[model samples]
Target: MKYLILGAGPAGLTFANMLLSSGEDDFLVIEKENSAGGLCRSCMVDGSPFDIGGGHFLDVRDPDVTKFVFGFLHEDEWDRYERDSRIDLYGDIIGSPIEANIWQLPDKKQERFLHHIAEAGCNRGEPMPEKFTDWIEWKLGLAIAEDYMLPYNRKMFGEDLDSLGTYWLEKLPNVSYEETKRSCAEHRPYGTQPGHAKFFYPHSYGYGEAFIRMASALGDRIHYNEPVFSIDYDNRIVNGKYSADKIIVTIPWTGVREHIGLPGKLTDSIGKLRYSSVVIEYVPENMDTKAHWIYYPDPKLSYHRILVRHNFCPGSKGYWTETNLTRFDEDKAAEEGRTYFVNEYAYPLNTIGKQELMKELLEYTASKNIYGLGRWGEWQHYNSDVVIRRAMELSIN
Candidate 1:
């Protein structure tokens, strides 16, 4: 059967590669942008490389996905480094993967956290809280929760904390009262597993190089700058133009439904889905530092996070041949007088009712031949590795 995949991000590319490698050659990958690697793409600016979509790291533990993607790279092509992330709260730098590094907090804050942990430990057998505030309070305690977690989450999601589901805690590390206090007293920050903190980065090119490599492997199967305006679901085709036996869509669900002229019920459900828009301001080389990623939990900051590109890939320096780098709004940027670029995204904002709405839309869409995957299409948040793994699973089968 012929397959038509939409959006050239990790999800679409993974599906395309899997199908082609399995001897299923009759497939096409469509991307709206002029190139692949959607938000993960990187560009040169004033002799430095900056990833438009924050910093994406490949630290997946899944062997199947890792072997398939990185198998092509030579040993020297990849650089494995431990994650050195931090949260910039006011002027203090707190060790990141935030929960594990609570000891970095001031003595008063530390004591408050310990008390909450102790209370939580005693109440471990009770039912977990449903709201985000309760989850943070229960997990980190009211003091830390109110001070950092809640405010940071609000800034990130652009919504209230109570709306979010507590399920994400599974990916986080939970510490007991004794452990937290001991770590604080000893001045030893709680460290996560080495594997979790370590990631494989391309030594020479930016992370986008990985996608470019994947596209190169596909030969003539990939198409760029092809914005699919419509899809004929009844006819099982794309743009009411290209005929295909099966369709795998990875674009925003709202856009997909608009193309197909979905019914009111479906349209209404899709409309309820909310998303956050990101602006990635790329600064000059001098601004680049050793920070892999910095989190701004403070609500005062307009941007949620800032990433340093030069630190991630030193080889990117060569690509910075141009003295002038493009800015998002030249007029405004000129006012500021700096070389920087920004990448914006309408990513699904997980609200209280969003999950349920997405579930309904996903169920409705799945009944059709089209398979929806990835962040916007699935209406769920996922890392690059997770997106690729899911796409691979769909394509391999």
Candidate 2:
């Protein structure tokens, strides 16, 4: 069967890579962008490479997946470094996974946090949470939930925590009482999001280099700047010309639904899927910080996180900061002569009923021999590893 792959991002390219390895030549990939690497792509900012769509760190725990990804480049193509992430809370810069590093706070702040932790049982077993907010409180207690998780999530997700479900809570670390106490007492690092303690990046180019290399290997199989005009699934026609027996799509559902019409209820359900956009400000001068990225939970700060690009690559002279706001104040950026890029769809939210709706949508698509892949198409808050794994799994199948 001739297969049609949609989008040439990591997911699409990885899937295509598998197809190519299997000697499958009939398949074709169509991408709206001229270049590969969807949100993971990076660009040059004044001779220095900077990530235009926030941070994309490579830290796959799966050995097989790691082998597959790193196989694309020579051993010397990438550089490895331990994660140097921190949080800026109440003007204090502390280790990340803030729950495990609260002891680093001042004496008064530590006492207050400890009292709250003790009262709330230090993230022990509790009833299942109904909303994302409840899940945070249950895992880290009211002190952390209010001080960081609640407000920070509100800022990051661009919605009330009560409205979002516990779909993505599994990503957050859930340290036990003993571990939490030990971390605080010893002032030792603890409870990092597993597999993120260390990561690798390209020594040259940017995070997107690997994907670009893969696309280069694929050559003419990918059609660039070819926006899909429509999809007539019943007749298996794409853009009124290309026809396929099976189709793999990596574009957003919002984009898909417009082309392939959906029923009112399904459309409405898919519409409920919310996303938080990002604005990245690329400062010309470097920020004097050793930490790679610092979370700004205080509402006082307009931006949420500041990512020092130089920390990842010494050649990179400056940093990039992200804000949830879409319409960036270009005037402010121009004053500092900082260039900024805005992405309208960055992080997808698992709003309440999202799981059920996504299930329904996928089932319907599968029935039509249409499969969805990637973060936006799948509408999950998946990391790069998860995205690559899904592509690998689909390729062999």
Task: Tell me how candidate 2 scores on lDDT.
Answer: 0.79
Which runs in model 2 stand beyond 4 Å of their true positions?
121-126, 171-175, 257-264, 330-337
Clashing pairs in 2: none
In angstroms, give how far residue 255 of model 2 lies from its true place.
1.8
Q: After superposition, how far is residue 71 of candidate 2 from its true place, in Å?
A: 2.8
Model 2 per-residue lDDT tens digits across residues 207-298: 88888887987889999998876777676678878889888988776765355555567768767778888888777678778998888888
Error of 1 at 327 (Å): 17
- Candidate 1's C-alpha runs over 4 A off are 119-127, 160-163, 191-196, 257-263, 285-290, 315-331, 337-342
TM-scores of the models, in the given order?
0.86, 0.93
Give candidate 2's error at residue 396 in angstroms: 0.7
TM-score of 1: 0.86
- Model 2 alpha-carbon miss at residue 176, Å: 3.7
The local distance difference test score of each candidate is: 0.69, 0.79
